[model samples]
Target: MHIVITGAAGFLGQRLVTRLLERGRLDDQTIRRLTLLDQIEAPVPDADGVEIVAQALDVTVPGALDEVLASGPDVIYHLAAVVSSAAEADLDLGMRVNFDATRALIEGCRQHELAATRLLMASSVAAYGGELPEVLDDMTALQPQNSYGAQKAMCELLINDYSRRGLVDGRVLRLPTIVIRPGRPNAAASSFASSILREPLNGEDAVCPVPTDLEMFVMSPGKVVEALIHGAEVPGERWAPFRAFMLPGITVSVAEMLETLREVAGDAAVARVRHEPDARVTAIVSSWPARFDTAKARRLGFEGDGNFREIIEAFVDERP
Candidate 1:
């Protein structure tokens, strides 16, 4: 299998690459080549048999993916995007990178005649908003309230249509807010989700921009990468009629996350978190439904973290 991963430089992207390399296969086929694409050069892993190709190119530019597509990748993980807050801050950049680049990549697959190439995209729960039910299910409608969500919702529909037309075998995973991401925060409105736990555990000060009671559906980085691989491996017959659904996640409030941190690390770690509200962050995150009925994902063999404490413990155990 020739697998390609965009946004290969990001946290999730890097983890996915490492996991894939460790397994050395996907869809039960041996991975012979792994192509990593990002706006900046992605790290080239030292693999024994696999041909590793790393390229730094902007997907928004015309024909940017043509060369990569010409190589005929059997599987593609579309993880690149202008994240939530960044997209909301700049509409054009969001549309170009999120929506347009995705469309072009789909078209590139079609133009190259790579029929039924397994293309799995990382979408967000932000795709749901505006008068939502107490708990969201697979059948819930997408009524995005932010630019990033709107763009992702658009791509979901496009990929589904293209899949129906037999242009590609596509799957979209509506990811929950990924928690306890390592390293410094990025521009995502939900960056605080990771920051609160990540910084405090490191004995550094962190800010909570939303109310302690504000709830969010969150998944750990490890489970997310697992779901991406599982989504790709599931047969297309099962995904017919609809190709997108939310991944299972635990719903927890900011206070709960801090409490878990306190249990795992110490009271001092929790004390490092300061409650400083940011209206913009609150508005965007609060609009998303925190609770979900992910029966569909569960039935499809996807699993989530047991609880916030388990998530924190896993991060602590794994962090270098």
Candidate 2:
């Protein structure tokens, strides 16, 4: 099987690539070629007998999707996006990259392949917004309050339409905020969720931009990857009516997260996090639903982290 991964340079994308390489197969088919495409070339895993191609190119550029899809990939994992804060700050850039690029990818898949290609898109919980239920569920309507969320909602609709038209076999996994992310923080407003734990354990002070009691729905990197793969492998008949849905996650307040960090890594590690609130970050995160009824995803075999302590321990154990 030939597979393509956009945003291959990103934190989650990179890890997904590594995990697929370790497994060496997908849906009982041997992965003969793996194409990793991003704005910058990401590291390639050392998997013997699997041909790896790493390309750096802007997905919005003319013919970019055509070039990436030239191999007629059997499956595509579309993880590229302008994150929450960045997308809200730059409307034109976000629309071009997130919306336009996604449309182009779908068109490329339709035109280039003789058969319907399997597409697994990485969506965000940002797709939910104002006037939400105390707990969101499969029946919950999308009411995006930010540009990032609006774009994802739009993409999900388009993916569903394309699937109905038999253009591509698409699956959209609306993921929760992944906590205890490795490496330094980036532009995401939710970056603090990971930084507060990651930086502290690494002996560096980190800022908590939101209030201590602010709640968030979160999952671990491992579980998110597992959900992604499961979304890819599951039979199409299993997804009725729509191909998009939210994944399961744990809802925890910031204070509880800190306590878990302290229990797993010590009080010194917890002390390294200092609260310095940012209104803009707070506005975006506060608008998102912190609890979800993901029974549909759970029934389909998607999983979340067991607890915040397990998430903390996993981050520390896997730290580079």
Candidate 3:
């Protein structure tokens, strides 16, 4: 299979590329070729037997998608997007990068391979909005409260339509706040969950923007990769040709997250955390739903780690 990963230099993107190699998909016997694209120059992690050529190109530029799709990869993992905070702060840039850029990818794929290709979109819980209802089922309607959420919801719709028209096979996974994320804190409001743990582990201070009681959903990069690969391999007939649905994950409160970190990393790591809430951040977080029925995804056999403790352990194993 020819596989291409956009945003190939980002934290999760790099990890996914590594994971794919570990899965032995990069071996020349299994993969025909591997292409990596990113906004800035990036080093391709050493993958034995895999032919990987990378380029630094801003995807927003015209004709960029066509260049990336020239080889017509069997599967395209579209993970490039502006963070939630950035989208909220800069509406125009958000629409340009997060929305328009993605549309370009879809259109490019449509123009190149038609019905022969598949796309896996990395969406977020942010796609949900405005004080999550008591319960969010697959049938729930989307009412995004932030520019980022609104952008993702609209993209899901376009992806579904593109699939229906046989432009490409598209599957959407509403990712949980991938816990144990390794990197500096990003603009994502949910970054605190990983930041509090990551910073403290390095003997550095971290901030908690939301109260301990605040609850939200989360998962690890391991599970996120699993969900994406599983979605990619699903037979086109397994479900109808076009349906963008939620991917299942676990939910926890800030207190729950910290407790799990303390248990996994001990009091020394926990001591480095500081709480300083910003009302705007709090209000945005408050509108997020902490849990979802996820019956559809669960029934489909997609899920995350059993507990946050496991998530914390994974973080330690990777970062420490």
User: Number of the top candidate by lDDT?
Assistant: 1
lDDT of each: 0.92, 0.88, 0.80
lDDT of 1 by residue, 1-320 (tens): 99999999998999999999999988889999999999999989899999998999999999999998998989999999988878888999999999999999999999998777999898999889888889889999999988889999999999999999999988899999898799898877889999999998888999999999999999999999999999989987688788899999999998899888988889999999999999988987898899999988998899999999989988888888
Which model, 1 or 2, shows the larger lDDT? 1
For residue 249, model 3's alpha carbon misses the true position, in angstroms, by 1.7
- Candidate 2, residues 82-109: lDDT per residue as tens digits? 8877788899999999999999999888
Model 3 residue runs over 4 Å out of place are: 26-29, 239-242
Model 3 lDDT tens row, 144-174:
8889989999999999888888788887888
Total backbone collisions for each predicted model: 0, 0, 0
lDDT of 2 at 234: 87
| Cα lDDT for residue 85, candidate 3 | 87
| Order of models, best lDDT first | 1, 2, 3
TM-score of 3: 0.93
TM-score, model 2 to reference: 0.96
Off by over 4 Å in 1: none
TM-score of each prediction: 0.97, 0.96, 0.93
Ranking by TM-score: 1, 2, 3
